[model samples]
Structures are given as C-alpha cells and as structure tokens.
Target: MIVRPRMHWLRMLFVWRGSVVPRILPRLGFFLALACLAVATGPHPFNLREGPLGLLGVALAIFLGFRNSTAYDRFWEARKLWGSLMIVSRSFMRQALTHPSPALSLEERREVTDLLRALAVSLNHQLRGTSVPLDALDSGVRERVVAAEHRPARVVLGLAEWVARLRHQGRLGEVLVTSFDDNLDRLSEVLGGCERIAGTPIPYVYSVMLHRTVYLYILLLPFALTGSLGWSTPLVSVFVAYTFIALDTVTAELEDPFGTEPNDLPLDAMTRAIERSVMDLAGEPLPPPLLPDKDFVLT
Candidate 1:
C-alpha cells in the first residue's frame, strides 16, 4: 500500500508512482487520437446525440460508484480480519505464558510461539498464492507444514493439539483451555475469511460488462461532442475517458486486495508485524518493523 506523508496540493497533481494515472495513460492517449480524428471528420458522423451520451455518463458514474464501494468493502474487511488475527494471537500467547499453574518451560514457550509465527507467515503466502518458505516455520513442524496441502490450516490444527497436550498434562484447567480454544477459533476464522476473499472475487461477468460499457462510452464520446465542442473535443473527451478508465482500474486492483500491487494491502509488512509481536511476547529478540520504499509503497 502507498504510505507517504501528506504532500502539498500542487505536488499531489504531479505525483505518479503510486497513482492509477500511469496505468490509464495509454488508454487516454488512444482516446485523444480518436477525438482528434472526430474533429477532422467534422461533427456527429454517426448522428450520435450529446443528450443520450450525457445520460449514459450519469448512469455509468453510478455503476462505477457502486462497484468501487463494494471493492473497498472487501479491502477494509480483509484489513480488519488481519487486525483481529494480531489481537487474538497476542491474547493467546499472554494466556499461555501467564495462566498456567506452573510457568511453561522456555522450550515449550518457544514451541508454541513459533507455531503462531509460522501460522502468520503461512497465511500471508496462501493469500497471495505463493509458496511458504521452510525456513519461515518452526523446526518441530516445518516439514509437516511445508508438506501440507493448506499450510495455514495445518498450523492452526497444530496449535489446537498443543493446547490439548497442555490440558492433558494438567498445565491448564478446563476453563482456561476453553479460553484458549476460543482464541484458536478466532484464528481459524481469520484464515477462513482470507481464503474466502482470495478464492472468490467480484463476479467476472459484472466486471467485464462494466469494462466494455466504459470503453464503448469513451469511444463514442468524441463523435458526439465534436459537433458542439469542435476543436476542444480531444481535451474534453480525453479528460472524461481518464476519469472513467482510472476508476475502473482502481476498483479492479482493490477487488483483489492481497495482490502485490501498489494499492493492495501490505501483507509483507503485516506478516512482519505478527512476527515482531509474537517474538516480543516470547521474550525473544524482535525483528525490525517494515518500512515503505522510497516510492512510498509497502508490499
């Protein structure tokens, strides 16, 4: 995600790297050429009226607004799920470390903490459809988790088993174990929610339909306006095309918030945060927090 400090209003106009303007520039240029051609050919060759096109623009704006809203809802919901994951992980670790009758051995504490760390890394990879590195896992379950079909789910199960073992060893009472179980369930929900977003996307047909309509509108716009605006058709048409095409491109990126795009959620930074938080709770050296790049983007 782009995480830059606020810029001056004038500087904002020229900013390029993280904005969608760069992505739509080629399309805007194409529209500009078409608009120039329309001007050369004289007015309304196809008898397309500005009135209908104006109404179409309004309708398109409404649809684009709706799609953008829906896509942002998915993006925000994903961020919240990750936030919940962080909270539940810390609570689970605090309970495991402080609630038992006798303090857990340092080795046992490391084992459980590593599982939580592994779970976070695995989930990050799973969402992006990338491989989980074996080195990112705990030694005890590294091979098993790497070999599993769903790495995050397997790590979640490992957590439950560890809690059950503690209960059997008389380290935790029924009530305390139940509390642990509840947090584990929250972890599982976080995993499931991420999977849902990654597996299912905004309906392909709806997106394609809107995409086609947007281009079609932009293509016909110059012809409609040339008769009225004449020499200024290219400027107006290209500006209108920029607005529609840019919005469409942005919504497409937000629809899959787990991607490595400039505007997508910063999964790498978030996973690192999970690691730092878990290590701090385990009384181990914490890794440094991730920072955005010079371009103000966090992957």
Candidate 2:
C-alpha cells in the first residue's frame, strides 16, 4: 500500500513500517554476537565449509518463494472476487433502471428508482458497519425497514415483495417481474459471495504453523552460516531474515481482504461508487466520487 520508487533504499528498508525488522532483528543480533565470538575466540572458525550453509540458503529461498507466491495468489483472488461483485452490482442497477414496467405510473416508477438508490446506500452502510439513514423513508416503511436485523437484504427482499404484490394486482406483468427477479437473484449472489469472503478466513492453525516455521528457519539460519560467513553473517542474516519475515507479513495482512488495513482492497470507495451509480440511475444529482489521497490511499 505504501508505494515507493524502486531505487529508494531508505524506504525499502523501512517500507513495511518496521514490521520486518522487529521480527528479524533479535535473532539476528544473537546470531551476530555468537558468530563474532566464535570467530574471535577460536582458531580456523572462519575457515568453515560452505556446503551445509549453501544447502540451507537454497532451502530457505525455496520456502520463502513458495510462501510469497501462495500469499500473492490469495490476495489477487480476493481482489478479483470483489471486482466481480462490483461489476454484477452495476449490472443489476442497470437492469433495474431499464427494465420495462408498463403498468406503473411515473410516480410509481420514481418510487422504484428511489428504492434502488436506498438499496445501494443501505448495502454500503451495512457492509461497512455504519448506520442506515431511515429518515428518508415513509414512516410506516421506515419503521418496518429499521426493525429488520439485516437492513440491506431486508430492503432488497422488500423490493421483491413489492414487485410480487404489483404482479398480483395486475400492475406488473409476469415477464417484468421475472426479469426483476433475475436481477434480484444476481444481487443475492453478489451479496452471498462477498459475505463468504468476509466471513471465512485461512485457518488460524495453518497461519500459526507457517509463521513459526518461517521464524524457526530464520533463527536457525545464522547457526548454519555463522562460521562460514563470519563478520558477514549479520548482513547475510538480515537479507535472509528480510525475505522470510516479509513473506510472512504479506500473508498475514492479505489473508483477510475485508479488513481496514491499507493493503486491503478499497471497499469503501467501491461502495461509494455503487451508491453514486445507483443514485445517478434515479435521476438525482450525483455525489462526488471518493478521491484517492496524495499518498495514493483510498478510503
């Protein structure tokens, strides 16, 4: 999330806001002291063979590479799923706007448009754990809508019920209701998918085991390399620790895509865009889009 130039050495060192060093430094320091003592107090310590250290380095490289790749795959998958949800949400809004309902009066059509806007806003608020603005609804409708636990889905189902009632009253034809139902189903699918991602996470035990493995590997690395690398052990340890720890950090942050972390997908901006589009469909003056920050952060 914190973008920096490729050649910025200072930023690169501190890019993850010191997250890497804290996890890496303690073990690294201990190893450095141990390596130094082993070299200074003993003869031929620096003449150690490189075969075991080389093999360990190779193994660490492979493990870090695989871990980082798998974590990146999960992160990208989450982004793709949310992107699809946005597209489907927009498609449902478009359908609601253009789908013909011949028997509705202009006022009734306007009410339907309003309902669509409300649905978008409510869903946005619901997903983000914000309050729904019920003052915009009629008193009886407002009370009923507010009483529901899942306000967004309630509003959506309420719209479907309205459509069904209209059909029963001969004000909406079967074909139009069916089309509307299809859009509703799409919306439901989108909601369900988002919920699935938000609710489920990579298991805690797996994460804990991976984290412990990475750390233990890093901790033992210097022991294997100390005699061979000597004074260069600290520098080598830092580099090696950086790779393993950074990979672990990446996975930890990315595993939960809906979190408020800077690295997470821009869900707030996404919801606002959906709200603006739905309101535009209602013929209302659109609210401004949420702008990216100077540092490229999105709310």
Candidate 3:
C-alpha cells in the first residue's frame, strides 16, 4: 500500500509513486500516437464524428464508475478482515495468558500463544498463496503445520482441540471456555472472509467487458476529437485517455487486494503487526513495525 501524508491538491498533481499513471503509461502513449495520426491524416470517410460522442461518454463513465466502486468495496472488505484478524489473535493470547486457572501451566499458556502467532503468519501466507516465512514461525511450529491440509484452518482447529483439552481437564470452566471460544470463532470468521475474497473473484465476464470497453473507447476517442481539435488532438486525447486508463488500472490492482502490488492491501505489514501484538502478549520483545519504502509504499 502507498502510505503517505495528505498532500495538497497542487502537490498531488505531480505525485507519481502512488498514482496509476506509471502502470498505464504504455497504453497512454499508444493512444497519444493514435491521436497524432488521426490529426495528420485529417478528415477521412471512416473518421468518427464528434457530435454523437457525448451520450456514449456518459454511459461509459457510468459503467466504469460502477465497476471501480465494486473493486474498491472488495479491497476495503479484505482490509477490514485482516484488521479483525489482528484483534482476535491478540485477544486469544491475552485470554490464555491472564486467565486464572490452576490446571493450565505457564508452558501450556506459552504453547497457545505460539500457536496464535503461527496462525497469523499462516493465514497471511494462505491469502498470498505463499509459504509461511520461516522467521515468522517458532521452532517445530513450521514443520507440523507444513503437513496440514489447510495450514491456517488447521491451526485454528488445533486451537479448538486445545480448548477441548483444557475443558476436559477442568482447567477451564464453561464460562471461561466460552470467552476463548468466542475469539477463536472470530479468528475462524476472519480466515473464512479472507479465503472467500481470495477465491471468488469478480466474474471474468464483467471484468473483460469493462476492460474491453475502456480500451475501445480510449482508442476510438481520438478519431472523434481530431476533426474539431485538429493539431491539439493529441493533447486533449491523451488527457482523456489518462483518466480512463488510470481508473481501469487502479480497479484491476485493487480487485485482488491480497497482492503485493503498491496499491493492494499491505498484507505483509499487517501480518507483521499481528505478530508483534501476539509477541507483546507472550511477554516477548515486540519487533519494530515494518517501514514503507522511501516512496512511502509499505508492502
């Protein structure tokens, strides 16, 4: 994610690191060249008349706007789920560490805390389709989780088994068990949410339709404007192309919020935050927060 201070509107005009312009520059240049060709060729029988473009522009804008909104909604929802994951991970550790229970030893509490930390890292791995970073796992935790069918979900089930064992030993009363279970359920819910987003993409048909429409409009637009704008067609057409192009690119990046792209959710940073929170509760020194790049992009 591109983390930055709020820039003045004027400064934002020159901001490049966080903008979509870089990604779409190739397409923008292509359309700019097309605009120049249309102008140089002057009028032609096949030239698109500018008079009929207004209605089509409005309709296209509406479709693009809706598509962009849908993508942002998915991005925001994924962020929220990760946020909740952090909360629940900490809460579970807190309960295991501080709750009064003669039957639960310090070692048992530590084991549960380690599990919480491993779960946080594993779930992030699952979302990103990557293996758990070795540094994120404590000794032995990695090897055991490697064989699980779904590493993150299995860690959660491992948590459930721990609870069952504690309850069986009468170390946890029904009331105490309920609280821990509640937070475990929250963790499960968060994992399920992230999985849903990662697995179920916006329908391919909708994406293809919007993608083709944006390109077609931008490519054909220069033809319409060149007749009236003449030599200035490249300037006006490139500006128009940039708007449509930028929006389309931004939407595509955001649609998969778990990606490592500059604009996607900062899953690495968020996962580190969860690790730190769990460590604090485990009575370990918290690691430093992950910093963004020089350009203010974290992950």
Q: Which ranking of candidates, highest TM-score first?
A: 1, 3, 2
Which segments of model 3 are wrong by more than 4 Å?
A: none
lDDT of 2 by residue, 1-299 (tens): 43334647776555543254555567657656655565465444345455765675687667657656665666677566656555655665565556545544556545555565566566656655778875754555566567888776776787787677777777656777887788778667756765666567766676777777767666555555666666676677667666767677766766666665566666667766766766576666676887767655675
Report the C-alpha displacement of residue 22, candidate 3, in angstroms. 1.7
Error of 1 at 276 (Å): 0.3
Q: Write one digit per residue (lDDT tens) for candidate 1, span 32-106.
A: 999999899885446888999999999999999999999999999999999998999899889989988788998
Error of 2 at 272 (Å): 0.9
Per-candidate Cα lDDT values, in order, are 0.91, 0.64, 0.83
Q: Cα RMSD for candidate 3?
A: 1.6
Tens digit of per-residue lDDT, candidate 3, span 133-205: 7565556666667778698888888788888888898878899899988988898898888889999988999
Residue 226 C-alpha lDDT in model 2: 61
Residue 178 of model 2, lDDT score: 80
On the 0 to 100 scale, the lDDT of residue 22 in model 3 is 80
Best by lDDT: 1
Clashing pairs in 1: none
Stretches of model 1 off by over 4 angstroms after superposition: none
